[model samples]
Target: MKPRILLVDDEENILKQLRWALEPDYEILIAQDEYEAKRIFEIMGPAVVTIDLSLTPGNSQDLSGLRLLEYFLTQAPSTRIIVITGSSDEASSLQAVRLGAFDYYSKPIRLDELKVMIKRAFHIHQLHQRIQQSYPGSAEGFHGMIGKSKSMQEIFRFIERIAASDVSVLIAGENGTGKKLVAHAIHNLSQRKDNPFAAVNCGASPEHSLESELFGHERGAFFGAYAQKRGKLELAHTGTLFLDEISKLTPALQVKMLRFLKNRKIERVGGTQTIDLDVRIIAATNHDLLENNVFDKDLYYRLKLVPLPPLRERKEDIIPLAHYFVKKLCRGRRSPPIMLSPEAEGALLMHPWAGNIRELENLISRAVVLSSHSVLKPSDLGFALNSIPTDVNLKFAKKAIEADFIKKALSKNNGIVSRAAKDLGISRVNLYELMDRYNIQIQEFKISRSSERQQMKTGEVL
Candidate 1:
């Protein structure tokens, strides 16, 4: 199929030149003014559009072209936009990027280089379009989640249900299950979708900061209280506030949170007024909240627990979830849907995902980038299970759990970091961070590859 192109310029010569150069690759449509350009856009819905910064009515000042770019971004975000600017207008060209223009080329067009950029942009456009078509939802609806398994379908149902109400939702899943993504989905689908969706890790922050962050502090409340600052609850008013790892909150904070849950009111650290909050609270826990005494039963009960079945128990959803994350992340790469060989699929089923869905996301992503072949084999998934010692505790340290999780995904991806990152829905940078955090060695991992591939192969995957 021939790709469609829309060319806009005030200068007659430039339009003719671009048409002559890019015509071999696309059916080019030329427009000399902003009004004509938009008309052509509405009719043609071109795959790629190159618009000059200066148009017929606003030749010297390029505000009209800027507005056109903004309109294009808002109306047809999948369309790749390349802005044409004068040689002297570097500042204005950069401003186009700020307005969400895909790429900018200075005037006095270099046809050869500009064509390459346009082609690359179109590829990315096509990829993102494919994602939208396949998912049938905005990025904010699904974001990084990739699942079609019955279990995942159930999770989607839960998200839809909770998003309709203001009741507190408690998401329960094993480590690395994308609970945070679920919380985000709930917020995005709710009545407060347009409002602030604030999040803070209950386990990560210091106790004092957690208190101040959840409940605002007045000036002179503590040593660091130089000025009055509203906490997360106050800021999240009329929005959704996500408290991740709720089971990890200190007992003291749990008591305070319980009060907030009941009263829907907060007292600043040094202030007397009890501020009311209209925020929806969503809490997540990797721990077995019902069994763990470390987690407050009163607060957990109040939060209204939503239990998430671990990946092991929901084996039917593995392939669907794998396809989802891979398709979503590979949107710009134009990468094909990754195929898992029957052996690979068996490996996915056999392994109990201790880290759950998060581990799966990292594995598939890594495999997509690192696999030379389109189909992923068992070896490609690094699924030779590592032996775990009985003494190694997964309960307390989040990093310890994360390390075990990555190791499993790496094993599934066959020690491929890029694939592992995708499988886990994390960036390659994050994979490296996990390696360091867990002190894992890739060499001991069964799937062998490049030098850095040897990095954390030895990490325990339990």
Candidate 2:
């Protein structure tokens, strides 16, 4: 059965557009007013809901949409509610997010962005369900991560214990051991859940760009600085900032970061003003920064260390994580439920996963896409029972897959960013960010004006 989603909006045109776009992937139920929405909620019990904050047109006094949001939460707190508001209604949208709504979107609706948000909501809800089923009567560790081993349980307990405190945290883990997820869990469980949770990758970004990205810069900060921009550190004020791969930070950047950690103030690039910020620092590293002479000793001493066990060490959790990824990747697809064959399960267990959880997920994703049969065997996963590839660069592999998809989308859309983003089921802004990360320029995919004119003259659509 398709995952059910409820759409609550007074505008008929919006409802029609949403239904047309989302009907293929979801069982969409439309409600034009609060009474109808309530009735549908009681009967259908949708897993996801999109509600307009101003349900009654030209009636500002009637907060029917917000009331319905409250009512839905009261009835089923697990149901993910996405609030829709006017473009200028920031206060109401923020209020919705604060009131336990999963997320909010503003009008006029960008279908790509809204669709991405809806898909995320469904994924989160299903993931929560999977975790509860996997752990049985265990306490909820975190929303987006799955772990059932003894070591993971202890780690969860540790997170819960330290989440309430305002001290700096340093998470040490291998590449695919989910260091960032742990950071998110800590931030979500803390008092700063509602605040912005900003993240930057020290290894992925260039050292020259990483500094400006971390700290805001004045308009005349550097040669290419056209306007003043707030960096991740400043933007994460009163929230949490996650610095991944912190061991890769340069000596100069390390000194600057350490200064900000010591005093809750930062001076922007080429700016004299020191801005005070109440941001919590959560840094992750694949290597031991203290043992490595490259990292600053003062910074190392300031952070509370938390180590994450790699997947190979916690072998008991491998099958569970595999099953979780299989379900997550296969959900909402128009196909029969896929299961792992006995041979496949055995092969998975025997393989030494050097790339950790990420490798497993990537393998499962490939199988899901390529396998025709419902039962996936060892061969379906590109794994032989005897010899499994152990020297895979999982990070590069994942990036290659992402970059490939973006290139295909851009090609299909003739290099138009908005169209490509829609084709990829993501916001244009998100697509641009990915393009930037991969150093993909739209100009590379653009057709020449002469070629376009030639095609037009030939009676072909340009």
Candidate 3:
């Protein structure tokens, strides 16, 4: 059976035209006014709806259509609503979108364009359903990490499985990808849950200070050591110690850390007495420590790795995560309920999310603080139609490298797709995909080859 769609418009001709065009694809339900539309919507629960903004026939000011749109959304936030308005009524159309309509189409709606918009709405609705169905628990997310993708599900399961063990664990991911959160979750679920969880940023302080922070210094040990101090490892005692940015640890500190990991003992700076501690180690890094050769191999091998996926790779989680952030931020501010406009959601989906979950939370927080409207549009989240990359150097470098490799391979192969694919060790299909992704014109490469050949021939003739 075809998917159901509700069409609410006062004009009989418009309804008939849409039914004729869409009947083949969707189970068409037509409503001539708000009352009929609401009745059908309540009964049928269609996945998509197209409603005219002015539903009171001659009264152009009547906003029953907007009210109906709001009602449908309130009933089912996942419902895709496409608002239709007169070509001159742009203000009403914008207002309808701001009220959480999926999209807006103006008068003189060509059947083809309207059909395309309806198709996109259904697609987005299906995605929302898939995310909700796949996500197991409430919107609070898995141990504070919000993700609906299969990768995240696996990560959650992995955390649960390893939380009972006492082995050293390493959580690895790009910066702002919530490595520290995972570390905390591991500790919270472990047997040492009642004990204090101590956290230290290896990269946040100078080398001497970081060493002193991790392994306490006795009085008179250093210039600022006015009193005997307990370090993170010592303070944690029977609990977990989260070492963030562990790759930044200096070689001297790494040696001391490895020794402690092996023997579960530590010596304070300028102190002879050795301290026996039973702290579980949970280290996190944004870089590949082993691959970079900056971290100690013995220490790296001791910890079990838990690699977290970046936000861009988990598109299914974007909307849910955004909503979660909005709710959290609004509740903190004692603000009323705020909804993300479909336009804003689309913008978020399109973004590359260089800064991952942290970036997303910050954007939503900014929007909630600054925007007075109950609904957030793309502009409210600092995202334009053409969104820019967040200020993350690593993501930019990776993109640049990938594009350069493709261009070099194409140049070496004289614009031949097969040869370039072989050079890049990828399929021709993949090469073409990459070329399209980077907006690299094959015609430019092919034309350059032709021009070079022509130049050679002209020189020979001369």
- In terms of TM-score, the best-performing candidate is 2
After superposition on all CA atoms, how large is the RMSD of candidate 1? 17.7
- Whole-model lDDT for model 2 versus the true structure? 0.82
Ranking by TM-score: 2, 1, 3
lDDT tens digits, residue span 244-296, model 1:
88877888988888888888888988889988888889999877775747767
Query: In candidate 3, which residue pairs get closer than 3 Å at backbone N, Cα or C atoms, i.e. clash?
Result: none
Error of 1 at 207 (Å): 1.0
**lDDT at 319, model 3:** 80
lDDT of 1: 0.75
What lDDT score is found at residue 26 in candidate 1? 85
TM-score of 1: 0.56
Worst 10 residues of 1 by lDDT: 453-462
Per model, state how many residue pairs clash: 38, 0, 0
Estimated TM-score for each candidate: 0.56, 0.57, 0.55
Stretches > 4 Å off in candidate 3: 1-136, 386-462
| Candidates ranked by lDDT | 3, 2, 1
